[model samples]
Target chain A: MEEHTGKKNYEVDWNEYLPGVAIDCVIFGYHEKVLKTLILEYKETDFFALPGGFVLKDENLDEAASRVLFERTRLQEISLNQFYTFGSLSRFNPEPMRIVMQKNGLEPTKSHFLLQRFMSTGYYALVDFKEAEPIADFLSDSCQWYDIHDLPSLLWDHEQIIQKALESLRENIDHRAVGLNLLDDEFTMRELRNLYETILGKELNRSGFHRKMVNSGRLNRIGKKNTGKAHRSPYLYRFNT
Target chain B: MEEHTGKKNYEVDWNEYLPGVAIDCVIFGYHEKVLKTLILEYKETDFFALPGGFVLKDENLDEAASRVLFERTRLQEISLNQFYTFGSLSRFNPEPMRIVMQKNGLEPTKSHFLLQRFMSTGYYALVDFKEAEPIADFLSDSCQWYDIHDLPSLLWDHEQIIQKALESLRENIDHRAVGLNLLDDEFTMRELRNLYETILGKELNRSGFHRKMVNSGRLNRIGKKNTGKAHRSPYLYRFNT
Candidate 1:
């Protein structure tokens, strides 16, 4: 199979792809106190989707997800958590997928593996928004970050996948120390609280949240934020390595 | 394909099974302060494994897992959570699987779909130990429960599957009210702590644990447990319904 770009053509051997397993990644990034996810738009179409790829027969599923993440974000060794596996027969809608294949200059019916029902494992990673440079693959028009609340209509079960990933993220926020990955190395308590509020989609009590954070032993007081106003400056903290 | 037993032979059509996706259930039960998992032993062999089954083309994977759980336990509507999917290329050990097939009167090479690699989704359900009647399917000689700490050698990455399930269980124990399913309707504080300790495989600070549990707002103090001694009586609690 060849990915037809305007200027270049990239070849992918269909036979080398695994028959029934695929990986879709929900890459969560925090920007401007809002939680966002990286998504790809199909060229010349309104379709948006999670960055996904088929596993190679020789690779593990986690490795396949890592490869997809690295290709899209140009980052490596980012911890990816496998949250759920979506195996419903209706996960793949034939109409939109066919349109996508046709637009990419491929015949969907001939791609038997792609046409058949397959299971997709959802993996999520929290990344610093500014650190990731989203690059679209040849099959997509562009890769962009969308705020979780204002997402476009996604194709297939990508919206549900994002929801599940978000649920997993919220369920694990307090226990997993994910702020280390989503926030800067040093940040004010307000930034951390905002990150949690954004992901959890709720307003947490300020004093109680601060007390819980301080008692968790996962953070260390590093310095004070140098706000222009002296009386309003807050202590900055970092995740204890 | 046929299941050969001492009394009768059962036939199954290989074509009816889903091609590449399967479900394995790690059914966990608690008894005598020890956490145990239900496993099956194949007839005329030492191979033990988690109770598992293949999905049907018309059924969802979760439905397939539920069916497998119901068949093994003679119970239905047991809530099972999908924990992880195992898709490593080496997950299926060919030698052992071939022996299992041959012993079951299946020509492995002739069963192309069975011989080819497949992916399995792992699910776990917590059940009351005494409430479950372990029944072996035609493929196995007997079904039994084994203590998680003293597990027998399992077949084909099942040990890893159980380990992953245990990890997931431990991670969710504090957050989700899973004790509602694992414990009796009413219990003492010590019993609740014991259940938590058994699932977590560690001892927790008694007063701190109790305080956290009480503050979580998921429990209700129904009454006091009269242990036949004045000093030994403890508060009986139930999960807030």
Candidate 2:
């Protein structure tokens, strides 16, 4: 069992944080044409969860989210977006929290702040994975990347958080300038297509992809001219460089 | 002063609402080819604000938002989108709230929940102006629709919330099936264009708009075949049926 624990292991200053609220971040990175999400393994427990923390009473919610994101990923530069908030009564199970506390050599108090019902604001960001130095939160043993498609069982509704974050990312992929964080400036057309495929979970026809990208005017073309009719598939994909 | 006041209004059981969190809705409507937003003018005060309410300890956050929306607009079935959560330190001022409480016959308790800091989730929805019978919240004198472009000075950061909501709605105008809420099924092309133009805050070329609408495959031709080339305005608008 890992001896590591946040300040809460001793005593939590309840007034330091806003009650009934927390923040969770779904940190995503793209590399080698595969999309990966950063997750944490809880200390001395089989439980895994998205990196999250509480909002300080004096801090803006967005600032609190950014602090949590920066603390784990160590990437200050980002365009973090708040996608959704989750607050279901079922998410308030105290059993897992008890296990976490006991395993970490801390006694569980019925009135413990961590054991209380909390609604979490879900924030997400796209970052250059290579630049991020992953550091585990005090409650977690380790932080690492897992393919979005393959992940261990997660705690609470974290799986749903990841799905929602991914959905939001895909929805705004065209306007979010995601490539600035995920790709090199001198990347080729094939590399860009692979990035789209990874995010979209489907293969796009090569000719059609080229036509759409060129027509979008977000990408500057060098060398030879390219042209083609997009395939008949009804899905229209747009990109922002 | 109007005599109407909300239930806690008189006695806000802090237990009823999850403290420090609330929900605000920027209800939108399109009629007479003009876009308007629902706003409330507080009773016994010159204060105006969006329709909002606190969440119960047992209720889902979205459910609370929907309840508030229903209480104000009385629209039960809708596609309400949570656009953003506002929680800046500047929004914590208790002066306006004190005025509201005093004017509403509420004793200004130092620890009053309404005087404390609150983070509000902003929600937005489109509706037929005729269908939504505007009812003022307990604290307000009248619930009325004001053209978004020409609105009275608003309270708190609600102006920002409305701007953000309208922006989000416009961003998704093409993708969201907004026609269902704002327009009749058998609407004419000119009417549909007017609706889009109203939300977009700009005029669209008639022939170009028709060609693009038809090409997007969201609309079916009524009788004689209509044809035209979309002007090269560089905007690629899509629509959902």
Candidate 3:
């Protein structure tokens, strides 16, 4: 889309000799004890994929991931990070990609220049689904969140990509504060507990969970909500930091 | 090293593509509370690097890392897992690389065919110093462990590679047993404490540390270490798993 200057930059020429690498994003969101991952359905094949876009030549890996998350998901200025880079040479199989590319009247062998040697870095964003709307871009038909356990088969190494992202999320729980990314501005403590239980795949003891949750010092109790079915009013707490 | 002619055969033209990507090992060893990393000094320049060799075409990323670790550092059959992949388009700079190639009487412009690509995944192994013997390879003039805290400037993005490996190590400490990777078959409880202190960059409370450690049931007390100057013999323990 842009032109190179009159003088050829050897660096540019060097890049032309190499295959391009890109980044993909797997955004996870939680609501009401259900863990879901944001995915896009491509127009023709109805094939589902994590909402992803290519990395720009000038962007850093981390920035590229954020850019894609914002552009495709309509969720801007959210925190995202690089978790892994999938680089198995077999990832570029034309047989699987041929179905999708050929539908657009493109030759898999000639038009897919970046496929053979390309590597993709996977990044993940933990965001609230209530704040996100799927923006169908060039290749997508619709965007939606699928339950982690009930995901449709994905293209390329996407299944493995989601698996790795979940693993990274589980491992990072102690150091990273994920609740803020997935929760609403104000929510009941039970809502927060349900979110953790779903992501961790286990039930937490109410008393013990409350103790640890308070000790983390990130919660601010605002008010209580009287759900008519409950004996006591459930307190609402917002993430302070 | 082996051809793929099995039931799940994937047919592709090998010659049209660049050579398969490889992994490099940077094994770190600790002794006397000082961290050390294995390095191989190359010819024609004062620059040095971690003792690393090529990954075989047919091997998995982890296997390739272990192979390089064993073949070059003489740390045989040790496990080394992939931590990060470094593959920026400009990662393989041809400018200074050309000089190095020329110094070795090779035409850099022609010889370095994979100048812009050649993505290399970096893996790290943590081993006890007593088990390793660094050997000189084709490009290596010497092999030895340099103190990690006082490392000389490294080639490429090797510094960032080391940082990522260490961060991964820290994240895995709670769920995975990393102490076993750096300890001998048997060790004293004090020695284990020292190792944690060095890695965590903090001094732990003796009673608190002992309580948490013993409760974990991962250590088996063998006997006692007879310190001649000490009033009481210190207990010695071995990792149970």
The candidate that wins on lDDT is 1
Q: Report the lDDT tens digits of candidate 1 across residue range B119-238.
A: 889999999888899888776888999999999998889999999999999878965547878888898889999999898888999999999999999899987787787576898998
Relative to the unseen true structure, what is the Cα RMSD of model 2?
A: 6.9
Task: State the weakest 10-residue window (summed lDDT) of model 2 chain B.
Answer: B229-238
Model 1 regions more than 4 Å off: A1-10, A175-177, A225-233, B1-10, B174-177, B205-211, B224-235
CAPRI class assigned to model 1: medium
Candidate 3 per-residue lDDT over residues A1-241, each given as its tens digit = 0122223222223233334456778889887888888888866886777776554445445666776787667677888766877766556655655666565455567645534445677888888878888676455567788999999999878999999998888766644458777777778878878877888889989989888988988789987776774658888898885
For residue A17, model 2's alpha carbon misses the true position, in angstroms, by 0.7
Alpha-carbon error at B212 in model 3, in Å?
1.6
Name the best candidate (by TM-score). 1
Query: What's the lDDT of the predicted structure labeled candidate 2?
Result: 0.81
lDDT of each: 0.83, 0.81, 0.68
Q: Go through the candidates in order and give the C-alpha RMSD of each one to the true structure.
A: 3.4, 6.9, 6.3
Candidate 2 per-residue lDDT over residues B1-241, each given as its tens digit: 1122245455556677788898999999988788999999989888989988888878888888888888888888777888888888888888988998788888889988888789889889888889999998667899999999999999999999999998898888876457777887556678788999998889999999888877878865444322343342223333344
Over A34-124, each residue of candidate 1 has an lDDT whose tens digit, in order, gives: 8899999988899999998888777788888988888889888999999999988778556776787788887778555667666889999
Candidates sorted by DockQ, descending order?
1, 2, 3
What TM-scores do the predictions have? 0.90, 0.88, 0.83
Model 2 TM:
0.88
lDDT of 3 at B57: 40
